[model samples]
Every structure is written in structure tokens, then in C-alpha cells.
Target: MPVNLADQLKQQALAQGFAVAGVASTSAGGRMPLRTAALERWLAAGYQADMAWMNNPKRLAVQQLLPGVRSLLAVGLNYYVDQQQGVGVARIARYGWGRDYHRLIEQRLKRLGRWLELQQPDSRWRVCVDTAPLLDKAWAEEAGIGWIGKNGNLISQSHGSWLLLGHLLTTCELTPDAPAIPLCGSCNDCLPACPTGAIAEPFVVDSRRCIAFHSIENRDDTLPLPLHGWVAGCDLCQEVCPWNKHHAKASTDPELQPRNWILQSKPQELKEWDDNQWDEALRSSALRRIKPQMWRRNLGCL
Candidate 1:
């Protein structure tokens, strides 16, 4: 059983629901041949707003997150569905339209890790989704899953931007994939499409102006006036991308489908909900992090 097990592990990942998987090593200071200047420029412009976690230089660097980490195995799961657009109901970002990706991706990674263990008992492994200190998107780009587009989301030639990135660091020295080529080319559609102009440049994103940021991480009882009517996370950028026009819809996972009422909720309707009602509607949703008051703040904006 002295095989290069990364290949088998990746196949298992695809079989387990991941659409794309690749491996790289971890060390410190983010991915080597750093993309720090672009990051620094974005942060210095005060684009991160209250999400101060992005300011941590170490968090911006992969090497610091896992010292002596030799490889990073990156995975992308497609979350798009056929009914991407509809009538009367507010749209949820395809990624969040299902069960929380953190739990979903972790569950699959754990299974894949166990499979790897059976293949190479001596290999050491660690799995990470969004919450980890490591920058999952950067590693995904390095691992060749896709290239980061102008809107700062990884866009695949085949899968477009509706991807959830996950990370796995292992001690084994598997062959790494060449970084994915930038398929975005000269497209600047995301720049003009953003209601708030969050995409400052081809590869830089000003999170402070991002509706997804205001709706998810920025938890103030009221969103800044600049971001209103943002119902949930924003998808204008993704909606306009040519590559996503014919994007494939993934098999549905029950937990990810929105509650009937949630899909049908209106701005005024959600604003009238009491705290208890809010809890019932978003009970197990990633939106729970926004809190009832914050939900009210979002609805009031609409």
C-alpha cells in the first residue's frame, strides 16, 4: 500500500460530493509567492470595516496558520441548483441556500481523511472549512481548483463562482497542482454590477462595501445606509458572469433547501416577525448569526 494516496483521496472526495479537489502543503505566512500586496491595499483602504479578523497579517498568510505544514488539499463543492431564480421570493446565495457549508464540507472531509488514513496510516491530516484561520480560497487557487475572479470569489471554467472552498493539510508530500490559470481574462462585469462597487479591481474586493459582508459578518443592529435592500447575501456579480450562464445545477441536499416560508418571505413580512418567529424561520440557518435584531435591520433597509 505504498501508493500516492492523494489521488485516491481526491477521487473519494468527488464521490463524496466535492466537485473539484487538489492538494498543497502548509507552512506559514499564507501561500508562498505571496498575494499580500493586493490584500494590504484592500485592507489599508478600510475595506474590511468591522470584520477586524481580516486585518491579522498572519491570518492573511497560510504558512503561519499551519507551521511546517507541507501540503494543503483543497476542495470545492458546487452548490448551484436549477431553480436559481424565481418570482416573489428573496433569493439566497446558492452556497447558503442549503445546509451550512462548514458542517457539510467538514463531514465530507472527515470521511475522506478516514479513507486516507486507511491508505496511509502514518499520514497526519487536518481539515478546515471557512472558520479556520487559514485562507481557504487562496489555497484553492494554489491547488488548481479555480482562479479568483474580479469579485474575489473563485471562478471555475466549468463551475463558475458558486463554489464552497474547503482545506485539508497533510504531512504527506503529494504532487501539487499547478495554480489554475486566470480564466477571467479582461472581464470587468463584476465591477460595474456590484451595487456598492466592492470589487475595486480585477482581483481585489472591498469587503466593507460588499452586501454579503453586511448581511453575514457585520452584525450591527443596523447596516450602514450605503447597504440596504440587501435582503440576504448579494449575487449580482455572480448573476452577470458569462461563465455561469449555463452553470450546472448540483444534486439537492435536503438540509440546504430553504424552508418554504423563508423562500416566500417578503421584506415587510420579515420585519413584522418577533424574535421567536425569527428563530423558528432561521432555526438552523447560517442566517442565525445575523440575529433577530439584525434581521430586522436588514428588512427595514428593504
Candidate 2:
């Protein structure tokens, strides 16, 4: 008997270190309109901050990303590690505590894309990580991998919101999974727990007030005083969520483990390091995304 393509792909994704996998059709129906409307509102409210690319039309429609797209293979990698926080060290988000996930996830996506091409030789595929304009969380939920939580992160009953997401868009027709239903019933822990109050409402995050945005993406020399202590990204919202507290599991992939320096170095220690040392310490690490100058700027606030 011939193997089921979707089943084989799901098994392959698990072999590639993905914790969850699901398929979604590219056809615009169901919740796509509502998701687009929410995005438009978010953009209009200036909640995206300097991320003007959030307005890209390609994000509103999967077909815009790859013409003739028929199905999307969504995969989530668990990057959560149960590590103790250093007493006075600046914090790095769990996702950035290890190797750059874009590199890690994209490599797996490309491999999966190649396998998919072999299964359907005539089909075309595009692998997308964070580099693309696609709404990853929306698609992840649509693909049945998880539900989008009040803090705007995709939450899985088994893996929580500590997932690094990636997708492979292909022209081949595949069975689509039913969308995941919202599971955050009456829980509003993440909203009040956010240090900067970025979660303005359920399922809405105001990036202008987001500590993670300032720590990682904001290029300004100074961050707002309230957004201190976060050297790379913020995990407060995820940390406070009941789902994460109960369901988050430590990742098994060695590539996702935190480097010793990232886990131990204090902000003062990081500030004293020279540029060359910074490069050496954070090489191939996601923390490298926050340039040394930004590190100094973030440290200044602390």
C-alpha cells in the first residue's frame, strides 16, 4: 500500500525536531477574513510600531506569497528550556537563548520542502520562517497546530506558547486539518502580567509598548525607562500564562540549548565586553540580532 503523503510529512517533521505539524489550504475562506480585519485594525492603530511591513498585502493572502499555492504545511519547534534565571543578569527570551531559530527552522523547512518535491515532482514550494511577511501565528492556528492566546502567541495544549513556527507553502494539494478552536477560556493572566502592558486586550498586542520589540527590533539609542532588564526579548506574557506553566516542556534539540554566557552573564558584564568579544560570544546565536550598540543601549536603561 502507498503511504499517505500527509502522514509521511508529519512523521518527517517530527524526525526533523518539530513538535507539532498540520496542513492548511491556501484558499481564502473561513477565518482568513476575520484575521485580515484584525491585522488591518492593528496596523491602523499604530500598534505595529515601526514594523510598517505588517501592512504588506502578501500577509493578507497566502496566494500572494506563492502563486498557485494549494496547501500550507505548518510546523512548530519547541524551544522551551527549563533553566534557572541568573540572579542579576539581564534576561534573554527562551527563543533567543540558543542558536538563531530562523537559521535552524529554515534549514528544516528547506529539507521538508525537498522531500515534498520528491513526493510530488511537478509541484513548487516556498519555505518561510520569520523572514516572510506571512501571518505565521494565524496560519499555525488555521493549520490546527494550536490556538492563538490572549497574548497573541500560538498556544498548544501540549507545547504551550514556547514554539518557534515555520511553514512550507506548496502547489500540491494536501488534506487540510480542521482549525484549532480557541482554548483561552476566561484566562486573562498574560494581560496584567505584561510589564509594559503591551497586551492591550485579548488577542491584541500594542507593539509600541512591547518590551520585546524595543529590546530586539527598536534601533533607537535609548529604550523607554519601563522597558529595562530585557536584553534581547520579553517572555513575561508567556511566563504568566497558565498553559505555559502547566504544559510547556523542555526542548530536546541540542541546537536550541542556551549558551553558557547567555545564561550567566550579567548586563554589567555584557556592557564591558568589546565589540569583538560580543561578536565572538553571540556568533550564530539569536542574540546577535540585537547589535552591540543596542545591547549597550538596553544595558543603559537597566
lDDT tens digits by residue: candidate 2, 32-91: 789889999999999999987888888887888899999899999999987866889888
Q: Best-fitting candidate, measured by lDDT?
A: 2
Which sections of candidate 2 miss by over 4 Å? Answer: 1-3
- Candidate RMSDs in Å, in order, are 2.3, 1.4
User: Total backbone clashes of model 2?
Assistant: 0
Residue runs of model 1 more than 4 Å from their true location after superposition: 1-3, 27-31, 60-64, 84-86, 226-228
lDDT digits (tens) for residues 221-274 of candidate 1: 777645435667888899898878766566575655656665566666767889
